[model samples]
Target: MTTHALVLKTFPAGSPRGSWPAEEFAARLREHGRGAEVVMDLVADSFLVVEAAPPPAPQDTSGHEASRLGAVA
Candidate 1:
């Protein structure tokens, strides 16, 4: 299954001095009830603070169709 993520922010790879801004940002997001995580992106050569996107709501058209058909003529 293909997974999707919502990228909240991006940061460059940290320096040797241990300045990890992406992780800090992710931590702040988590504290606010967001399931955020920091992951390294080789293709982009940077760190990404991302959250898993919720699944799309199902398209339940049966109720709508029924209601439309029940209209008084």
Candidate 2:
């Protein structure tokens, strides 16, 4: 199955004071796995949810570099 990154944002329950970093949210998602869910406490009564997906592959910079080298050659 194709993996995708997801993010959810929610408001605080009854107070206005606190926030969660994206990294923190992502960590929770990783721990939970596919069906995991989390409610983040955002600034002044706000929250967020985060999901994880297979990390993207490294970019292929070698191809571009090779092309440039060929041109120089």
TM-score of every prediction relative to native: 0.72, 0.36
Once fitted onto the true fold, the runs of candidate 2 whose alpha carbons sit more than 4 angstroms away are 1-5, 15-34, 64-73
| Model 2 error, position 66 (Å) | 12
Candidate 2: residue 43 lDDT (0-100): 55
lDDT tens readout by residue for model 1, 1-73: 8788998998877545768888888998889999999988998889999999987855656555333456332
For every candidate, C-alpha RMSD to the true structure in Å: 4.6, 9.7
> Which candidate wins on lDDT?
1
* TM-score of candidate 2 on Cα atoms, chains taken together: 0.36
Tens-digit lDDT string for candidate 2 (1-73): 6646565645345543454454465566567664445555555455555456568855656555334345322
Which numbered prediction scores highest in TM-score against the true structure? 1
Clashes of each: 0, 6
Q: Give the alpha-carbon lDDT of every model.
A: 0.82, 0.53
